[model samples]
Target: MKSILNRRNVALSGGPSRLLAVAHDAATQRTAAASDAAAHDPHAASASGSPADSVVEIESRAEPAAGATLPGEGASGPRPVSTLHAVPVMPAHLNGRPVQIADGAAFEALRAADELTTFRVYRCFAYTVSLFFHPPTLGYFVALHQESVLWRALKANDLDAAGSAFHLMQEQATRLADGETRRAQLVAQNAELARLIEESETQAERLRVDLQRHSEQEQTVTGRQHQVRKEVAQLEAQRIAAQAQLNKAHRALHQLKVATSEGVPHLHAR
Candidate 1:
């Protein structure tokens, strides 16, 4: 019993508590058998000395049996490492449709399987579905996956069922992809609209600046025109005064000529 407990404790999978339970059960059974044997043999208890001593001897004898290897284990040391194979408990078809993988073993096997073909959808979001043909079982498996985890799976034994399952998964993926494509397009359109709005605002600002500069030029021209009008008025008044003074000087010269002619007229008249 001690040897069995020690061996079980050394197992890679089951922990020490399991070993303890197994040891306790084995010890009880051996004790009960020894007690029966002793009760049948009137002198057996005397021969064994005590119940504890008998138990010790039975455990020692059981050590060799405990050491013997179970199926798939080696003759000595730890049990051999082996891969788990999922037994197919699900029916091949249910109501003329390929059955989904709900069995624990089948689901695990699907996770460990390598993909024969895969398709990814949803653009930025990574959603995937894959097809795999398990050579051992000669069946097809399809799975819906995201990251490292599989969300759902289907199993099929023949090509017709496999095709149906594949198409079903493909349809689901395509529907999701359609929504993602629309979302991507909407984002792109929004970005483009924002760019156009920015450009329009920039152009409007430039036009505003140009209009302000043109207004300043108009104001400068108006100020210069006012100064030019003032100069024109002053020049007009000066020209009028100069013209009047010249006309008066001319009239005075004519009058003096007339008086001189009057004084000298008698000789020519005669």
Candidate 2:
């Protein structure tokens, strides 16, 4: 998605940060310059008192014209009031990354409309960068990261390269966000897979226990079959012995009957 400038953004145009940073630096310089001037120029100190006195004097006579003199103000005649304009300063860092201020086209345009803009300056590596202002939206963007060559091109005033780098930076940021999201998703998926593997192992363990029980039952059945076979064999042998004994008794009885008949016949004949 094309990003809308919010917490993260930048415009790699003409020296925007350079201009903003300069503007900010200019304000501080102006105050320092004023102090220096006051100390060095006796006439200035006589007219406007001192740097400390000038501040108070300016505050009291906010609308006094330059060269306007105060009553009882010694020999230096009337002293013009110092200009009281605001000095613009950009933030020192963007999202914890150290940055250096550079010039930008957008800032130049805004500086042209100085009455309307609150421009800012920044540092991009060893290079300087800038930001634009819009009174209507009251919004601006701070670039989190930029391509190395992109900043170099922007510094060299290579707008073509700068624009390309800007686009590349956008893509880089989106890809990074996507990469993190995918990583998180993979981590969650891996956790789920690990859980499934654990459950499968538990089920396999139960099946193994069931298989062991079945094997033991089978062994018991096999042992019983062997015992029954031995008992059948013994019963078969006992039956065979009983039959033989009965047959022997029968034979003896038959022989005894024959002998008795023979003895009776002999007695009758006599």
Candidate 3:
């Protein structure tokens, strides 16, 4: 029963240093008690094992053996402290800092004041403070957590402190959310700009290709025009030479006819 009590205490503390100290003390006490019994009767030493063995047994009971777990714990380890209490033993951080929240009546007052404020920010994150009114303590217990991890908690009879903490956490959470939103917007805008730049570059490249093709076409058309002009000049020269030869033939025919008429006697036109 005493060993069981020691084990319960060790489990409740859940600190390795504390467990070691408690185990050592229990072992020393058991060793002294065993030594006393053994001195009283020499046969008692043989009946019960050595004092060293008793001490070892006490120490073992005081602390779980390596790789062993307490009742209700898995082989991995004991459950987190938050599971047993309203808040974590060590709170997790957000952006390298923990958020503070107020509990109970203070939380209600802050919420009411927030509604009246013109610039209201929405709660975009899952962090929140929960409150429970304790009849026995006549106080409010405030817990800040997201999922299974509790970030901060307090019990306050003074509602103002709890309210201040709750609103502060709310503000911190909103600021983080707004920052994330801005970052996302910037990233999207940059991506859109990059896409536009790539599209413009592609269009410019296509225009360059079209310009090159049109230049080649113009060069081919200019060469064809030059060749056509040369052919037209040659045709014009040939037509002029043909006309001169025909005129010479006509003149010769006229001279021959006149000579024949003069040689023969000719009657005047009557």
RMSD of each: 17.1, 26.0, 19.1
Better of 1 and 2 by lDDT: 1
Model-by-model lDDT, in order?
Answer: 0.67, 0.50, 0.62
Scored by lDDT, the top model is 1
Candidate ordering by TM-score (highest first): 1, 3, 2
User: In model 2, which regions exceed 4 Å deviation?
Assistant: 1-170, 249-270
Summed over model 2, clashes come to: 24
After superposition, candidate 3 runs with Cα above 4 Å error: 1-170, 249-270
In terms of lDDT, model 1 sits at: 0.67
Query: Residue 257 deviation, candidate 1, in Å?
Result: 11
TM-score of each: 0.45, 0.30, 0.38
| Worst-scoring 10-residue span by lDDT in model 3 | 114-123
Q: What ranking of all candidate models by lDDT puts the best one first?
A: 1, 3, 2
Residue 54 lDDT in candidate 3: 64
- Give candidate 3's root-mean-square deviation (CA, Å): 19.1
Best model number under TM-score: 1
